[model samples]
Target: MTTTTQERPTGTTTEHVDVLIVGAGISGIGAAHHLKERFPGRSFVILDALDARGGTWWTHRYPGVRSDSDLFTFGYRFKPWRGASIATSEEILSYLDEVIADDGLAERIRYRHRVTTASWSSAEHRWTVEGTREDTGESVRLTTDFLWMCQGYYDHDRPYRPQWPGLDRFGGAVVHPQQWPADLETTGKRVVVIGSGATAATLVPALADTAAHVTMLQRSPTFFFARPKTHELAETLRALDVPDDWTHEILRRAYIAEGDEITRMSFEQPDELRELLIESMRPQLPEGFDIDKHFNPSYRPWQQRLALLPDGDMFTAIREGKASVVTDTVDTFTETGIRTSSGEELAADVVVTATGFDLSVFGGVSFAVDGQPVDFPSRVTWRGLMISGVPNMAYVFGYFRASWTLRADLVSEFVCRLLARMQERGATTVVPTLRPQDADMPLRPWAVPENFNSGYVMRSADRMFKQGDREPWIHLREYAEERTALPALDLDDDSLVYR
Candidate 1:
């Protein structure tokens, strides 16, 4: 996979390759492996905006930063995860490093090359991608036969922080979990964490170890799944001297099956499932605690992701009087603490806003097709992999209810298969088009609120691509269904117009 650079008349250098991948994170690295394994002759290069690899893992350095999803499923399908079920960010990054080194993917990656724009030319039958080097701040241009977008769907630089009145008057230091300060001291300090998602759950227990007291202030409650860090099946398999590969596969399948059942119960028996989840936490918490006020969520289980509390550590911290929970809205930020709507002033020295992040479409890269600016929301998705009318391009949007890597691996295989088909037909360009039957198909938001309504997804609904109400056009959130459906898709179908 050789790349050639030629000087342009404008005094800029342009690199050319058969495929240009837009990220070097988990998805991008997985895509690279697939390309090398199947299409070894194709020239490809990976461009990433970050200074290093491990997109989210590298960016987030907050206390107790870890994977909410189990590592067995979160890890790439091709690689075996021998670590604990719930892995820290460092462990995950180490695993990713091994994959890059073993597959020789490090050289193919260009870190700090932030893509700014991408333009597709029908006449030239190629895409011209433009960006700047973060290290040198110089413009970089590249052209490719196929553009693969593996950038994950969140803004790493900016976090979604809601404005509260009198925040400017707050005397203590305020921070967001996304951009945790390295030198910030929490030892023996009163800390108040905002939001009740996975980040807050992970932070409370971790901060409580050093902080005088850690309080989790939330606008509402979120469901949490508490279990031991190590999987029982994994231990059993290891005790039986099972091979790492076999154990990985077995545990992966076992978790997926269990998750599928829980997902099904969330819809079919929501009330029962909700009670069971709340009951599971009852025993973990102190006796006579107000579980209903703090643990009960309004939405059904699996409506959004359930935060995993390994070994019920957070509850243990609360029981030990090191941390506590507050279910109320923030009235305003006081000089030394936050004032809640219930007329309670929660004193704190440092505030950590775990209020989540903003979604980024295509890494916020401006795109144009044949000189016309691409309006993503106006276009429809093709099997949730490619957009209709976008030629020679594919993006990875993972499943909301499952481990994100599951969909990433599936998309890589589908893209490879599609590329192979195009090669066999000697086609230079292949674009998703609306077939005769799809002309009148009702278009819906990429993710319907009824199916999965996470805050980020709902907030970015207007900017997301549309999904059709039919097969090969809608985004299937079910991994089990997509595992079979995506591979069985007929590349010769009229929906994909190749020339």
Candidate 2:
């Protein structure tokens, strides 16, 4: 592992490293830790386009921004979360800071480095990565033996904003939660938040506190699990003087088990699971609150990610008359507010669009393999870690149903193991290849719509890589299965070719 800066003739400086980890978010941090701990001889650097380490957590500053999943699983496997199950953006950032400080990862990260392109040279067995330093506006270049992408799946720069009729004619301020204004005043303001996903669920209840009235307007209903912010087991364990490490492992496994059960129920008995979820919310709402119309969704549970309403705060807001839910289509944006298709007008001074984000493939960086532009959709995923025909590269795309960090940890271990194997084989490059038996396997969309069809995913389906029907060629978003399978994977298998 070596690192040296060289002045290039083109006015850009080039540096070389053993590994180049993109995105200094949770996944990248965990990857860096694993690489340093397992292979201290290797040198690496983490590059993030943002100025901070926490990717989504750093970018999203909307009121009441918090994790939809519990911290036990959402937090890194090696780290113990001492806070409540649901953590706010500030708390999450503090936790990430601890990870960086404790692991000595702060110096290895290059913030404000936006990677623009990655060109892989098969003959050279390396990737030439090019980017610009956002702070200085200087062109930056780097070459690496391996590339690890943990930039996440969304385009942080561009949130999905639906062009509604008469949007330009609206009299008041229209704000997207992604790019929340720091100086925007909501106190005593009539706020109408659009969309029914986790963002809306989080924003409405929060804005209702100061806003004169807040309404969450949605086209359709989405599944939400109203859960307590604190975990009883975690509290009990801490009360009993259990060690943090022990508590963390126990709670992590416990949550994974519960999540696995829910996932199974979603596939095997969706209707039953759906009823259970909705019924749980019924008691929290006012009597005869029209649960069938607002709480119940047409789709089955887990088909899309479920939002977690910590302590049922959203329902409490509604019951307290501070916030309300309106299930209807927006006919158009009126001068003051919005008019529903049912001819009802919602008067608001501020409109918050909590609509979802746009999916970004490989951080929207262009890729070239042997000087030929690589088409992601034309390739297939290998165990959901590495893409076929892409050499010495692995990405972190975590579980949608469970905490994302679970798979990030797993992928870190897998990559370390693969790197060690490559060293033993004296191989400079390794890429996934189709086995003889896999040649005729049917290729499907990265995520099957029936399995998990979030709006952002459906909108970007054509840009994602394909998955095969067989082993070593599919991404089984099951943490339980991947936890065991990834570490025990046979590196000598023919699915991977080493040179």
Candidate 3:
């Protein structure tokens, strides 16, 4: 590959490349695979802030960390997940490592490279990217024809922790799920896990094994679903001697179809579906357990991401008296525990703020056009991948309703196809710009509030780009629809300005 070096007064090292991918996690690795397979002639580099691969998996090391979604869909479409359907964090990281080694992606990855700013130059038909090395504290610059953002939406540096009165007075060690300390001890301690989402759900069961007593403190209840660790389809296929790839496709399609059916059912007959879910889980809990109080959610299914308990592990722990759930708001933190809004006091040796995530768009990287800062919220989203005014750039944002990698893999394939089209036409730039006719289209929230009620997403709604009401612009959440539309999307569409 041909390269050029540019010198500047700021003492930053600069290099020219064809593509710059901003992440080394599942998305970036998959994107690199697509690039190498589909467009080998182009030179690209994967930059990661951390010194290692597995973006979120590498950072989050809390107990009982695992994927809520099944691995058949969460795993890359090209790669067959030959392990359990619900995989652990370590297992997921190992899968990523295997992919990296098998695909020889390690050669192209630049670790500890944190992207700080990206400025697009229309005249030059490239982006001037600036980043810092987390290890060496050296500034580096790269000018590339295209910028691919697979950095994900959540901020790893900050976890969403709500302000609690008298928190400082609490003598016990307080922790957040994001920055789990390696040396922290939980064995034989009374741990209080605050939050009702997936993290809290996973932690309570796992912590109960070692902790003297584990309490799940929740302000509101969330709908929970328990799935077996193994999939029957996978087992049957393996027994039938089906090829890994073939079995993967069969299972992937089946899982997608099932999820689609559930989504439809939840929207169509919410009450019936809610009752069915409650009844299904009722048998797993102890008799006379308050199903309506602790298991039922106010919002309909799929309103927020559903919590998945692998192999009914959480319920089993609860029934065994190793764990318990407390439904009440925290009025204040006492010296040794918490005071509840219901005038109840709970004693604890440790408190875990499993609050949630601090959401970010474009991974908190500032974008500029021709030296002018770009206002992300002012721009409309183009097909959930690219911002309308952003040129030659695309973000790999996965679906909340389905496996994240399903959408990510599709985005990679679509980008490669689009790049090929651009190369064939000898075009240097392609930007998704709203046509004059698209002015009056109704603007929709990135995540429609009625459908999604996640705290992090709702809190950062104003900072995200809006989606349109029509096709080619509307960000569809269904993998079935996107899988068809994205691969077959027209490169010469009026919404896309190709040069």
Candidate 4:
């Protein structure tokens, strides 16, 4: 790898590196480790739009912000998460901090530097990345041989806020979970959390402890799976004097097995699964609680992502009269609180919009190939990592049904393998291209409409890449299947162009 440091008249510096990994999130940090392990000779840098390292964990510091999945499965394969099964934002951020410090990645992270546009040059076999520094608004440019997008699929700058009528007239402070204030005064305040997704589920229980009352206002219900905060397997392994890494691997596998079973049962026996979930949660509530109205969703299980309710905290809060669920539509926002369509007015000191995320593919970055804009909707995803027709680019997209890092680890491994093969063949560029028959293959939205029905996904599925029905074209969300298939995938397949 060669480095070129040039001083422009505008006081901007243009640097060249072998790889440019965007976003210093869990995926980007993992990608850095993999690159360093596999291709030590290569020079790379991680660019993050935020000033901090942990992406989502750093951004979302709201009450009860934590991972929905277990830490073992969500963590990197190379590292063992020696913490509770479900970790908080602080724990997750600290884990990432350890990863960065241990791997000497702190010096490599370009924090506050956001990449706004990426254009590929076929002749030079490089990508020209352009962006502005968040703090200074100064232009920054990076030329790299490859681009790895670990920025995630959602926009962190803004949360998805619906245009509720009379929202402006509300007397209370309206806040979104994404842009949570550090010194948010919720104590003794009647808080109304809007939406029934993961954020809402988490915020309601947490705010209930101190707030006068927490009301989860949802138009529709979401399927929630109760999980224990602790894991017996880890404790048992510790008693056996097993190494942390060994114990972590075992727990990770166990979580994967559990997730797989849940996914399978949801697809094959959705009704049975739904009923089982309802029965499990019913006992956690007080007598005469309207389970059907508050917990019952119109869609089947796994249609939308299940909110992992760790240790029945949400249920306990509701049962204790600290928090309550309001299943109704917002007719409008009253001066004091929200007025439901049923004429029930909720009075609140603060209203928290625990709404879904704004889907921003490529971190809202512009892309062009040889001066022509690369239309993402027209492209197909290859193995759920790289986009077809986009040269020397790969993204870390995790499984929706399982842990995020499980698929992230696999994608990093695949990229390393691909890099190794390229080095062996003296190849400078690699891109996934469709064969003649692939053109005939039916093109569906990246997130299949029938498979995934999450509000955030449904809102932005059309702008994303398409996935085909056949091999090398489709992206499977199954970790067990991907683990068996990804490593053995033929690098020389007609779909991939290596040169």
Every candidate's CA RMSD? 1.1, 1.0, 1.3, 1.4
**What is the Cα-based lDDT of residue 95 in candidate 2?**
96
Judge candidate 1 at residue 62 and give its lDDT: 98
lDDT per residue (tens digit) for residues 245-264 in model 2: 89988988888899999999
Which residues of candidate 2, in runs, are more than 4 Å off? none
Query: Whole-model lDDT, candidate 1?
Result: 0.93
Quantify all predictions' global Cα lDDT against the true fold. Answer: 0.93, 0.93, 0.90, 0.90
Q: Please identify which of the two predictions, 3 or 4, would achieve the higher lDDT against the true structure.
A: 4
| Model 1 agreement with the true structure over 431-493: per-residue lDDT tens digits | 999988887899898788888888988898899889988877888569878888888889998
Write model 3 residue lDDT over 1-499, tens digit each, in one string.
6667888787676899899999999899999999888877778999999979999889989998999899999999889989889999999999999999988899889999999999999999999999889999898899999999999889988888999999989999999988999998999999999998999988998899999999999998988889988998899999999999999889888888989888887789888889888988899998888988998988998888889998989899889998888899999999999999999888999999999986787888999999889988878888888888889999898988898899999999889988888889899999998888788988888788787879999998889888888867788567767778788888888898888
Point out the higher-scoring one by lDDT: 1 or 4.
Answer: 1
Question: Which residue pairs collide, candidate 4?
Answer: none
| Worst 10-residue lDDT window, candidate 3 | 471-480
Sequence-dependent TM-score of model 2: 0.98
Q: Give the lowest summed-lDDT range of ten residues in model 2.
A: 476-485
* TM-score of every prediction relative to native: 0.98, 0.98, 0.98, 0.97
Q: Return whichever of 2 and 4 wins on TM-score.
A: 2
2-114 in candidate 4: lDDT tens per residue? Answer: 56777777776879999899999999999999999888878999999998988899888898999989999999989998888999999999999999989899988999998
